[model samples]
Target chain A: MSDELYDDLILDHYESPYHRGRLESASCEHTELNPLCGDRVQLQLQIDEERRIQQAYFEGEGCAISQAAASILCEHIEGRTLGEVEAFDARQMLDLLQVRLTATRQRCGLLGFKVLKTLAYAYDGTAGTSA
Target chain B: MENIRSDFPILGRPLADGTPLVYLDSGSSAQKPQVVIDALVECYQTYYANAHRGVYQFGVQIDEALEGARERIAAMLGAAEVEEVVFTSGTTMSINLVAQAWARMVLEEGDEVLVNEMEHHANLVPWQQVVRQTGAVLKHIPLTDDGHLDLDQLQNCLGPRTKLIAVTGMSNVLGTINPIGRLVEAAATVGARVLVDGAQSVPHAAINVQDPAIDFLAFSGHKLYGPSGIGVLYGRRELLEMMDPFLCGGNMISEVGLTESTWADLPAKFEAGTLPVAEAIALGTAVDYVTDIGFEQIGRIERALLVEAQTRLQEIPDLVIHGPDVDHKGAIISFTDPRVHPHDMAELLKRKGVALRAGHHCAMPLHARLGVVATTRVSLAVYNTSADIDVLIEAIHYARKVLRRD
Candidate 1:
């Protein structure tokens, strides 16, 4: 109910989330599973021939961090190169959230970025999911 | 002894919001006293070395300190042998070890393990894991409508295939103090081993493992006014000796060159690598502190708080207390305020300098059985006073007024 505990950017993103749904057709897709907290997210991306992200869409439910992170993330990475998207990490996400998270809650904030990064690596035709 | 309140330096400290901290989340993790903290600091500063390995002066000193801690814990639990104690990371890890070692070693396909519906995940998950690995069927002894384990149905649940029975000494979320002696006796009649999860029980009351003739007992230091990252698993020496080691590493191995190796004795076989030395030593001091004050006095102080809290909380309309029908529960109360969500209640209490835990309290089944999504829990320790209960009740009323406008 109060934005005091959340970052202003995160609160704004949560209040007015961007790219909050799935693309009709997508080139790459990823899902983040936080086993500890049971927070889950599935991300779908539509990319062009140049390997630049044309549209990034995510649809999932979790705590505020995951929702806001996914919303804020989609807004930031649209039309960006895969290399540029992989550069976003936990620190940047936490900075965007505008609040400090405990060791347990950090996974919630990092869920969206982790999924997207893995997808970015997949887009480059790289193997494995831990990107 | 000075006010006993002075023994906890953290109580004298202020919160980040400049409010005097009111900790009501002892059921989650108890706050440490000055004595426990000092004991830990002394152990690390003065006697810092691995246990049972080195022959040097510091190593010998550290070994004595660590063994001394184990002995104190054993004595506190009324264990017959010092060798019964095994130090672990926490109660979760301790229960996991029992599952890995005892259940995995002894249990086989067509065997069964019986647990209760009210058990915490720490008590429930390990049994599930063992059963999964061993091809054993895991069964639940049903809970009565009022939350007591149904002894009548428990007999039906037990049969020829029942290999083990694991249950909690006290419900962490519901605050019910189960009749573990009766449960152990029932399990023994079928020739099954019993493991008691004592994480919630140890701090609230005195426990005697010998009286119950319990096969194994496990508890965490942090839940008993000591440090985190430390727990004790006490198994009957004969049973422990029979079971294989859970973790095989440096300290657990007796001799290792290349292909062949011999394991250490009972307790050491389980404790591998660099243990939580500081936490173990602090646990000894915590035992001493509890003993000096006497368990009856501690129970009295807590019981008074519980009684007052129950009476005061009942006065609030639409407040439902979850647990057994009897008044013999532990010094903890889990309740749902119909007007407020538990998470919102916890957040509201946090702003008022009171710390409480919200959610299923790691006992989701119990919460589910009670027909509620979640509840806020207020657990007590020896340091808790009547004034603390008053503060909590006052805060709840404030939360209701502010948050419950529907």
Candidate 2:
């Protein structure tokens, strides 16, 4: 089915969503919610040796912004380390997503970025996992 | 009635992509008519003056305008007197006024407040807070499978200790037209004062406060094709005289000294400092416009819309209607496609130039009782037509394909 409702960026993320699962024996976990719209997401991260992000996956149910944001985030940060991910913020993700989000939806779309930042805080100056 | 749609300016405007915007969220807020706009503009341009305390020419003129607006609203509701009408900031504030003024004065530790499960949070929360403050138990009357209030259960709920009953004239979610007369009768047996939430009902049909013998009736101006931030709370003159004022200010108080104070009379006592004078006058004009177009005509059109929507929605196999399937139901229609979440459905509809509400719709208790988490709601008004329902049907099919991945 063709969804003319969504722009190309959203359609791309919907069809081939990234970070759509959970990382096994993950190194970090965080949850985010959009109370107004009832959108929620729980993200789990796994870091391998050499301080590289081995995998990042999230499991949750929400509107287009959240699903597309998660997919786009995973696609971008799969190979990057915590340092690279921490450097980015809501503005960078909003620029990448390139969609018109209301004030509340911006928060929903940026929740993953916030969770990743918190995980980066916990993983600060830490040694990589044995995996 | 024939030219009713043309009176709305928004209906003539196009969306960003030049698609005609089909508005179906009248339950959230009704579109303003030309008469309402003119009334608002007239107040700002010509009759811009403070009311009540102005002994001068402009003050007296504004005072007359405000009192005339109250009388018009009273006539619309079949209220016994104009003094029974107290203007405030929409239905939420009106309800809170009753909860704060009357409930605070009367309710005691052992008393109970009876509320229908179908009430909006505005009505429910005030009573909840009141009960918490007074140590009074808050009891709920369950809704039937068809979304109608269970009168039998209501009877059981209204015991000797029951002091108040707050019931919705119409369920905003289910479109169920509850029998307010019967609820009022039952509550009367327990000597309980009833406040009818007419926010959803008065917009779709004519309401008579006196005929129902309801102690209080509350409705918003915006929902009835008027301006926002304005609403009317109609209480029996005796009841209004009995209750204390909720807010204190210049207009509400009669005499104030450093040590002692006295309050104003009737409507003025309830209205605080500065009032929404323009909105109140515009509301009166809206009532005139609605009366001229005829509520019976509006009801006939709404029935047609409901029938068309029900037929189209029922065509989808997984679609389930949430309320009583009767002609008497209001124009509001809420339903859910089994495989699709309501939020996705609403987004898809928006892309098709359709505007509708999605989610629990602020009636969490009723939705929870109905055994569904959430549903998409397409509410109708006089401005809506059958063609809008057709587009909504096509949009729902499109939503099913997208969300269900069929």
In terms of lDDT, the best-performing candidate is: 2
Give TM-scores for every candidate, taking all chains together and pairing residue i with residue i. 0.79, 0.89
- lDDT (Cα, tens digit) per residue for candidate 2, span A23-57: 77687777776655556677777777666788888
For model 2, residues B1-406, the per-residue Cα lDDT tens digits are 3478899999878899987888999999999998899988988888689877678877887888878888889998999888899999989999999999999889999899999788889989999999999999999988788888887787789899999989888889999998888888887888998998999999889888877789989999999999999998999999899888899877998899998789898889999889999899899999998888788988888888788888888888979889988575898889977656677778788878999898778887887798765778889999888778888888888877776567
Model 1: residue A73 alpha-carbon error in angstroms: 16
The parts of candidate 2 lying over 4 Å away from their true place are A1-30, A45-57, A71-84, A95-104, A118-131, B371-373, B401-406
Candidate 1 CAPRI assessment class: incorrect
Candidates' RMSD to native: 5.6, 3.5
Candidate 1 root-mean-square deviation in Å: 5.6
User: How good is the docking of model 1, as DockQ?
Assistant: 0.08
All DockQ scores: 0.08, 0.34
Evaluate all candidate structures by whole-model CA lDDT and list the values in order.
Answer: 0.82, 0.83
Using DockQ as the measure, which candidate wins?
2
Write model 1 residue lDDT over B1-406, tens digit each, in one string. Answer: 2377778899888998798788889989998888999998888788787777689998899888888988999999999999999999989998999999889988889899999899999999888888899999999999887778988998899988998899899999878899988988888889998999999998988999999899989999999898999999999999998888888887898889799888988688999898988789889999998888889998888888788888899889999988864386988888888656575577668777889887778887887688775778988887877777878888898777655332
Alpha carbon lDDT of residue A112, candidate 1?
Answer: 89
In candidate 2, the residue pairs with backbone N, CA or C atoms under 3 Å apart (3 or more residues apart, or in different chains) clash, namely none
How many clashes does each candidate structure show, in the order listed? 0, 0
